[model samples]
Target: MSWPHVIPYANPIYFLWLAVALLPMIFMLLIKGKRWGWYQSLITLIFLYISFGGKYWQQGLALIGYVIFQTLLVWCYHHYRQQKNASGIFYLAVALAILPLTLVKVIPFVDGGAAAIFGFLGISYLTFKSVQMIMEMRDGTIKEYHPLRYIQFLLFFPTISSGPIDRYRRFEKDLLEPPTREVYAGLLNRGIWSIFLGFFYKFILGYYFGQVWLPLLNKSLMHQGFFSWSLILYMYCYSMYLFFDFAGYSLFAVGVSNLMGYDTPKNFNKPFISDNIKEFWNRWHMTLSFWFRDFIYMRLMFTLIKKKVFKSRIVASNVGYFALFMIMGVWHGLTWYYLLYGFYHASLICLTDAWLRFKKKHKKQLPSNKFTKALAIFLTFQAVCFSFLIFSGVLDQLFFHH
Candidate 1:
């Protein structure tokens, strides 16, 4: 028995697999007929290609089976659109379609097939987009639903792997009218820049640090404590690693989307530089934060706050901040670590807001200059790293006192 080493790569197998899979999309771009059908098939294929990788073949028949079902869903939505104009019907259809994914994702939680079935890499994203598309269709926001375009939108390879999570409207706009040459060039340039930066951080720097630190960090947590000050230090390292890690992925997603002529949302905007937690969210995983804000926060704010439950700024501030970041944690994954991740972030944001308000009472003494900006960036970065520590679950190890 020996320690086995596996090397990660921009492997040729992966590239060839992608090339073969994306052929249909290329054909769709060039040919002038039945664009939607070709595009949908291409999208689905790309999803499979990117998500499964070399091991994707293990589930071969089942994977194909899933795609086929989703295709029928595409047709069903198209036909439903043709027959009726009710937005609720489309929403219902999407809701119905999601049951399969929900079942697949949730069942393994109690069953034995967790890896084979549950915890699918891309299902979370695909499900979100599918629901979004149908809702948009019903709302009159999307005037038409070609089955192919629907497939293409849901399964586009670049986004399928992981996503910056574009909405259907933007994808539809791109499909009907892609960017101009200059735009494509800009996209390509951006994509390249993004990928380079992402790889350097995620791959190069991340690899070196993880190789040296993760094992030690893991050991320290068990020997030390999970909630102690020791965690505060390793949490910093975890935060750094997590930043380069996820930021790298987001960078790739943005760059890749741009090259493909679709404008996925900007996922990060130097979030560590933000002066407040709300602003930090704006700067980090910028997409998910907004997704929760747009789809969850604003709606809840409208519905919940208006009811006048103890109406106070302090109350509203705490409630809104808690709900936002907790959901943000849950969005990371359906796990306890993620749940705590949300709690940690919400705490920071709440405390930060409280401090700001307190500082406002003594406004003239507050720092305001380049130094302040730099300090804000440093503090935000550290705060975010603390969030990452929770996210990574190492906080349980590093801070353990028992």
Candidate 2:
């Protein structure tokens, strides 16, 4: 069979190759307390080729162009920031950074549902990093931009395709400061365990849910109708599949990053057990949500508050949630389901905030107990599952197509 290496961490063979290539690097970290940069660079190129080479050569070219474009954009923005941090210039730089991603996201709808030529697998994540650097540069958090280190941070292969999306400052710190052997030993242990756990989650559990159960439930929905028991079953099953598949992938990404001496932030954190929608955001796809929080929601709220756009802070906060989720939804895709998914989550969070405020005002009147907490978890779980169903896009297919 041909190599199923087009996708990262999805195929067993890809991990096999990765493990072999990482052997020397792992040993070096364990023994010498330093990474061989040349060797690291070599493996990165090889893996990037494996992911973007041959049948995907167009993607490879696109990635190279994209990287160069972002590197230059960042460099220019850095230089501009040094001279003067014009809000207008900062906004323009941010816009330019995300322009490629915007085209990639919007092209399908505009171009008879065709993928953009410049779109690569990890384009969104890369754009996030680029925009982050620009933002930080505006804030003077990241004062300097070294093109090579920027490229290394942007293209770090382990978390490349789908990320735990490392921050440039955090990544650069690890790159500049190699871990001690003792520290690396712990990281190595965690890394290996995470990989094996990922295998179980993705190959076994994710396979069963996504490959077997999801397909069967989907077929059942087609025959049994949208309001049937099957749909309910499908919702929960699809949620499980999504969690295992994505969380498993995140585990693998984080695991591999640990091996390479970077403390990549985790994407998932027992999200299923979150007590409320706000708590869920904290626990789920954490990197992405946190990125949105820091870069999008926080910034927008700051702007609104600073400008006194809304009469009340509560009103401003609610408006911020809607804008944040709508933007996030649009980022996900131009589809109705994706938009609804974002809207639904934003609504949930806002309502949760209202409840929290009311509960706080009531103080001793509203009971705080195990039963209340469990009930909240249960209700929040159902709300989140429904949101995931919207995200699954099966409703659009089931209702619109059939």
RMSD (Cα, Å) of model 2:
1.4
TM-score of 2: 0.98
**How do the residues 1-402 of candidate 1 rate in per-residue lDDT, one tens digit apiece?**
422111112333543454464445434433432235445555555446545545554444444555566667756776788788775776578767677566664565677465455334566677667666665655567776676666677666666646777787777787778665556657657766886787787777776556567667667767766565556767776667767777777776676565455677878787666877779887877766666677556756765678877578578767877888776665565677888878887888778888888888988988679988788878777767767776776645444533
For model 1 the TM-score comes to 0.77
Top-TM-score structure, candidate number: 2
Evaluate all candidate structures by whole-model CA lDDT and list the values in order. 0.65, 0.91
Which segments of model 1 are wrong by more than 4 Å? Answer: 1-47, 58-105, 137-139, 224-233, 305-320, 354-367, 398-402
lDDT of 1 at 358: 85
How large is the C-alpha RMSD of every model relative to the true structure? 5.4, 1.4
Q: Which stretches of candidate 2 lie over 4 Å from their true place?
A: 1-5, 112-116
